[model samples]
Target chain A: MQILEFLNTHMDMVYIVILSVLLGVEVISNVPSVLHTPLMSGANAIHGVVIIGAIIIMGKADPSNILTMALGFLAVILGTLNVVGGFVVTDRMLEMFNKKKPGKSKE
Target chain B: MGEYLLEISYLIASVLYILGLKMLSGPKTARKGNLYAAFGMALAILATIFLYVDEEGNKLQNHIWIFGGIAVGSVVGWLAAVRVKMTAMPQMVSIFNGMGGACAALIGLIEFPHYFGHGGSILILLTIFAGLVIGSVSFSGSVVAFAKLNGNMNKDIRLPFYNIINTLFIIAIFAITALLLVGTLTDPMYVYLLALISLAYGVLFVIPIGGADMPVVISLLNSFTGMAAAFGGFLYGNMAMLTGGILVGSAGTILTVVMCNAMNRSLTNVIFGAFGTGGAAVGPGGSGVEKSYKEIGVSDTAVLLNYSQSVVIVPGYGLAVAQAQHVIHELEELLEERGVSVKYAIHPVAGRMPGHMNVLLAESNVEYDKLVEMEDINPEFETTDVVLVVGANDVVNPAAKNDPASPIYGMPILEVEKAKNIIINKRSMNVGYAGIDNELFYHEKNSMLFGDAKSVLVSLVAELKTL
Candidate 1:
């Protein structure tokens, strides 16, 4: 398969992926337990990167095929919603956790 | 040239994502961290659409569909984020997370033909199948979780020999996947069937999970979706996608473990224990005759709180459900105004999600310093004059310590029972979410105040004012 040939040519890139993944997990391990929900939510939004793949497929598909077009359209919509909603909601939730000014009490 | 540009851009985005996650660990810098990560995402998307090229160096051309889809989705997502209440945040998370899974599933659906008919490797197929099964399961399971959390479905359905049925389903899924890999099942029908079966299995995976364990379930499903996306990344050979998915998968798994430890339940038990299923599995603590708890009027509670030198308030899902965070904050203020030092005790798993109670309290503008974690404030309970428990149960239950037979025996609790005098507000004698009777209620120092949390807090605030 042509696919393996293409990937085998880019075998060095796999190291980059492995390093990035390890670093990402290492950093995330430091987050406190309290922020877990928002963390999960924010990560959910990041995986919305699938929309990029969707965009690629939608662009190249035979524009006349109504079924492929519709599926691609739905994919983009759902993916974008996941990304946008995940970030915005996590931000809003985190915003609620601001520290009060030390001297300003009884607000 | 275009490929290099795309990779460099993704590298930049990945660094920003890592930086954002690092900053999120600190409370003061969390909002900034979210912005950084969002900026990273925006960079990845824009760069991909504008620069990435096919083997033939063709870029994406359907500008209208891309922008239109994003715009519509942006509007919908913004409205949902703005309108949702803190108490219902878990529900919103479940629904949105499910969308991510649906995206992965749909991607596999679209690309299946390329893998089957076109030149495709076994590696690609492996990744594709992983995405298909995981995505389908996460999507359907999250829907069930959403329904349960939103109160649309209350029962935890467990058909006869549920474990055997699930095991068989899993076995069949593997067999079918093997057939596909071997080219024995090239028909699109097999993939579609696999998706359908996985989707059905997803529903079953979550239906048996009890209400209290929903948070862990949510985290686990979130990880499932993330792994699916990782497989999607592998399918496309995309670095940014792979990194992001791995980050989510690991983080979600860690959080689920933390939640399990908080409940003192093993991860295995959570998946199979079926704590809230029928029979004696429902509630925690003793199954013996109940002792009558002393009831205190709202006025007495107000007086007790006002006179106390130090007071600790424990809040739970009851506080969230009644939307009483604002009133409770008011009560804290009133007590502090009278020179009574008021503090809050927050359990890790209090309310629906981790740190949710903290968010709820913060929404009412409670000071961060006043909100104490169970580990820190738990010790101070003994020296405190009064411990007011608002809509909390299992977290403060002594049964977790004294009753080895209790399901939650090993879970670390708030130790509110150590305080000099204990006061609790609840609608009635109904057990808490763990469906367990709180032996703390029957303690000699405990005085139960009956009413809705919001109204009761309002009454307590008024009484504090009169004092």
Candidate 2:
């Protein structure tokens, strides 16, 4: 009975949980075609967002709270890292497009 | 009051994700997709912060630690990305995916104890467990993948009793997880140990896989990371997390299937075979069998194909790495204008990734029907007047058929050597990724046009125009 009540009150959280499970299952069970590599790379950029979210959540608190302040700082740092890393990866992928084929004659 | 603002932000973020995905569908728009996705993530992060601040500002007082961690991670990530070469991009990706999984697992660990108290519930517990399992596997599996890609891990490192050891480790992981769930092991130390053991199991799971199978392994690990992220989202009641996680997971799974098809191997064989170990061997006589095969020069190939009834072009990773597909397509077009029937023969696992060759061809607007898989085109090799192998090695190696000592023996390959004449574009008498000499290069029927794939293909196309 207590469990059921807990579930009702936390229905929104439960929805998140269920959705996550479904997503996870989808990720591991299927295969992807070549077209999806760039998509995956793009999605990976979301890691930066996660870092940003973690930062803001921690940052809005009182600076006097040293631990919270530390977490906020960490979030910012990680978020920056995520952003930079994602851009570098995207750049490298783009490099594949820039190369000229070998057969073109040089005057 | 601010709740509405948060909702609106989420909506915008979701739209960005959709647009980003759509843009990513084609090569030309891939850059736009990346930018859109990044922008959406930024929005999502901002909205999440707004909502969380409104709800529980006090609990998030550990901002300092978060910031410090972020700073350290960013510097390291930046340095790694800048230093890594493009050739090693796949390994870098695997490593990053592993890190993401580690982060998700760590988050779950930190929150698991909180849920154990009055505030804790079964739903949270399950989420935590899921995170731990997925994260641990992704972490270790990715490490092994990294090793394989970099050649740090041996491709032939299969243990005699690998299955037995793997079984034992899996059992141990399950048992520990069960104990933790049942409250028989509530200590943080125990949970940490469980994570460690699970990670070890993941490593073991991937180490036995051969280098040829690394692409599939990379895709599988990618999915694992997505699932871990989704679980983390569920634990925290994050909607964007769920959606992004689903997208990655589904995409990864599909890629794995495509890779399996390309290799002409089943997923079961890939997983259970611990691919890359000793398989059927090619015979000693295989190398000598092709001695009667004829060799052709560039001019000879030009002359022969000029009057050929039909021609097939087979491409491999060498073509992609050399960026030669466009030229090959051009050559094909040239042949078509001459009233020659031309088609591309693609061997599954021809390139670094599954469908790699296909993607390259597609990028050049090569006709879809001209792109043929190995199974569909191998039979045509016998009757085909000419087979042009551009920077492809192992896939068209006749040793796979006759050489019992060959590492790739029994692996299905295009019988390009069976054609009336075979012209192979190569740089040297060098072996392929498997590091073994190709006997097909010396066949009397096979002519080696030594040069870069792109350069040779371009010359061929140009030469074809003259003919």
Chain B TM-score for all candidates, comma-separated: 0.96, 0.74
* Fraction of native contacts, model 2: 0.27
Per-residue CA lDDT of model 2 for B223-303, tens digit only, reads 776767677666656667666665566556666666666555677777776433454332355454544334456667777
Error of 1 at A96 (Å): 1.2
Candidate 1 chain B weakest ten by summed lDDT: B276-285
Model 2, runs deviating above 4 Å: A1-34, A46-107, B26-31, B54-86, B113-119, B281-313, B319-348, B355-386, B397-420, B425-444, B448-467
lDDT, candidate 1, B171-226, per-residue tens = 98899988998789888799999999999999988988874689999889988888
TM-score of each: 0.95, 0.73
Native interface contact recovery, all models: 0.60, 0.27
| DockQ of candidate model 1 | 0.61
